[model samples]
Target: MLSNPYFKSVLWLLGFGGMGYGLMLLTEPNAEKIERIKASGSNSKQSADDQRKALFMKRLQEAATTGAPVYRPQPQVDKKDS
Candidate 1:
């Protein structure tokens, strides 16, 4: 049974998978530290709605600066057109 090629391949694949999982567990602490470093770089801490408003304001400012036409579709247009 030990000499069977199919059994040997299955055991090899399982061993590699176990080793990969173990490596991920071992590196979890470093992964958390990397995440903390990434999160610390942000300047403003705003709520979700506030963040969305800020983004909208930014796009409006850009449009005004670049003279891009603002799209205002007629309310009478059917939603099916979209």
Candidate 2:
């Protein structure tokens, strides 16, 4: 059986799968820690989004007060030239 290619492949797959499953179990987080991790992740993401929005609004406000155009037209180029 060990000399058969299919049997060898099956053994390899089972060995790898068992090792991966064992590692997963060993590293699995408890429910409380999982919840805490999730909350922190969301909080950080929200704050990051808020910061980006504030920066964008500030830039827009500056442009508005300074009478600078926010949207600029792109220069036209012929495709054949490139």
**TM-score for each predicted model, relative to the true structure:** 0.41, 0.45
Kindly list the per-residue Cα lDDT of model 1 for residues 1-82, writing each as its tens digit.
9999999999999999999999998877777798898798575767798888889899889888987755763357557854
Error of 2 at 30 (Å): 0.4
CA lDDT, candidate 2, residue 41: 72
- Model 2, range 1-75, lDDT digits (tens) per residue? 789999999999999999999999999999999999888776445676798898889978988898776677446
Q: How many clashes in each candidate?
A: 0, 0
Candidate 2 segments whose C-alpha is farther than 4 A from its true place: 35-50, 53-82
Q: Model 2, clash count? A: 0
Kindly give the stretch of ten consecutive residues in candidate 1 with the minimal lDDT sum: 69-78
Q: Candidate 1 lDDT (Cα, whole model)?
A: 0.83
